[model samples]
Target: MDPNIQGGSYDNPSQAACAHGHYGVAKLLLERGADPFSQGGRFTNALQAALFSESEAIVKLLLEKGVDPNPGNTLQVVAYYGFEAIVTLLLDDGADLNIQDKTHRNALHEAAMQGSEAIVNLLLERGTDPNIQGGAFGSALQAATYHNREAIVKLLLEKGADPNFQDVQGGLFGNALQAAALRGSGSIVKLLLEKGVDPNVQGGRYGNAITAAACNNCWWDDGREVVTRLLLDYGAILSDAP
Candidate 1:
């Protein structure tokens, strides 16, 4: 224990215990009237620090003691590290599955953005909206597609994510097919194509996935060839006009 926190307020003891994964010290502090939710210094609280450290034991202890697992800091840490176990614990404890962060990104969005397939599946199993939007980058599908997470994309598709859904920007910017093409994820593109994603769906500066791939130079050689052939096979029209 740090000398500064040894004799400090109840908040300090719990915070220090959480930081160091001192479950016994944390329990002691809580038993001695420490508020597990207290925030001080750089530490948001015992629960937040435990989640940050990926200390499953400490997190379970805090949850058992009734800490707010849905607190912004707790959610942030869970989302940042893709802690599938902690996420499950928090959900079982009734953490808000749709609680958004400062940027309006919920835990689902975070998991998808990081391409954590396990976390994504867990969130979806718990009824998290696959199409929840409002992140800096938009929906969870957009995050997965942009990152070229083919597994996540396939999972989201299986879970009924709207591949044709647009973002809050009022355009088709977040379309899964467009993102896959933009990133040169040919496998994802092929999956989307097979799923009946419109071959000519207009999005961003380009009119469709093929155009987007062509314009963004997503495929240098064989990637371009595959994308073009796939689009042509799907009846995508190519024109000289902008």
Candidate 2:
């Protein structure tokens, strides 16, 4: 077998083997001196393929055989997809916990969006900054809040995620309160307000939570009113005098 010969237009033999979870075939390719570091399209290396599949076993094989785990997007992809076991293995193998993607999103931000509390905790234990802003949701806490991941949001807050964190990720609105209110997550809105997030705080697509409730036409009035009432209960004094 020609070690470098591509299986077809999309990938080489090793890449194809790894992509299909053909662990034995991949092992054979490696034994025959196939390049473990070969890149094709989105998957930059065979280790990426290994992690993309049933993982643990394949990833372990790649690591033992001396494949470069590389950097940049690898760890972030694994975290984004909620592969806890693989993430742990990669971390143990010295993958950077704070490695950012093209949008400057780290593993923590991905885990927060995915509601993968286990991975979030692992990243935090490794010193991942919860307030680090990037991607559509800005901070990891905002990501969790936007998705109504109440458990994850609370966990982040407990770990010092700023409830009043301003959005710098270019999201329509730049605060967790706006995100929660617009999405009709009344419980999440209450949680943020309880955490001392100012309901009257001005920012985002709508200037404040009151305006966010007024402008979000996606939800029915019943839902919008719930969020509006919650905000008013939190001392958000409204006026058109401005």
Candidate 3:
């Protein structure tokens, strides 16, 4: 047996410690020349794996050892899970709130996509861009609306998110109102309408808010009736002509 290959595999000791929640083992590994920031397959590191497991103690231990909390692979994991504590820890450790992944989505975008209101609020407070775009989802507002996160949508609106912000792909791609309408969140739709979002604005595939609602079937139930009434009250066209 090669002396260098004894005990545990040297390359993945940190990851093993993280998986087992053995902070002491992790510390020993770090002392014995383990790389705290080693990225293995899929860009996953010990810190990222610990965060994914929501192992707060292991995460803290890694951070204390100077592991970066906001590695790109880890950011998506934390954001996808709406891990508020980990997110705060990462931000406090100097993680860039505005750093985008390959899809150009920041933490705020991920929080919105998951409808994690607390995480979204925290990110916004930390200066995450509310309107950052990319991904198939569009903006944070659109993500919130798509997920039917009415409370988050309201919060984003209060934070000055553009109700009519166009999706980056163009042709009504990023409209929060369209997202709300598509999800059949009547309250959110009404709120968008009140905020002056055009009820008849044509989204790329859905055409208009009404059509967006109608196409979703579940959204076309009684919930959409209230939305339709609100749109009509605001002078949305009832005509079939685009």
Which candidate leads the pack in lDDT? 2
Clashes of each: 0, 2, 1
Task: Give a tens-digit lDDT track for model 2, residues 1-242.
Answer: 58878656437877767777888988888889888877774466788777667567778788887765555587888888999888888887777777778878788988899999999988888788878777777788878977879899989998889999887557666899988887778988999998888888887777777787767465545467899899888888789312
lDDT of 3 by residue, 21-129 (tens): 7778777777777777776632257886676458777787788888766676566568779788878888888888877787676778788889888988888888876
Superior candidate under TM-score, 2 versus 3: 2
Score residue 88 of candidate 1 by CA lDDT: 83
lDDT of 3: 0.73
Q: Against the true structure, what is each candidate's TM-score?
A: 0.85, 0.91, 0.86
Instruction: State which candidate, 1 or 3, has the greater TM-score.
Output: 3
Candidate 2 Cα misplacement greater than 4 A, ranges: 219-222, 240-242
Ten-residue segment with the worst summed lDDT in candidate 1? 1-10
lDDT at 183, model 1: 70
Local distance difference test values of all predictions, in order:
0.75, 0.80, 0.73
TM-score of structure candidate 2: 0.91
By TM-score, how accurate is candidate 3? Answer: 0.86
TM-score, ranked from best to worst: 2, 3, 1
Candidate 1 lDDT over 1-242, as tens digits, reads: 34235345324777777877888877887877777767664565677778656788889998998888787646645865888888888889999888887767778877887888898999898898888776765788877887778788889989989878766564335577777776777888888788888888775645567777776445444466677777779777787315
Full ranking by lDDT: 2, 1, 3
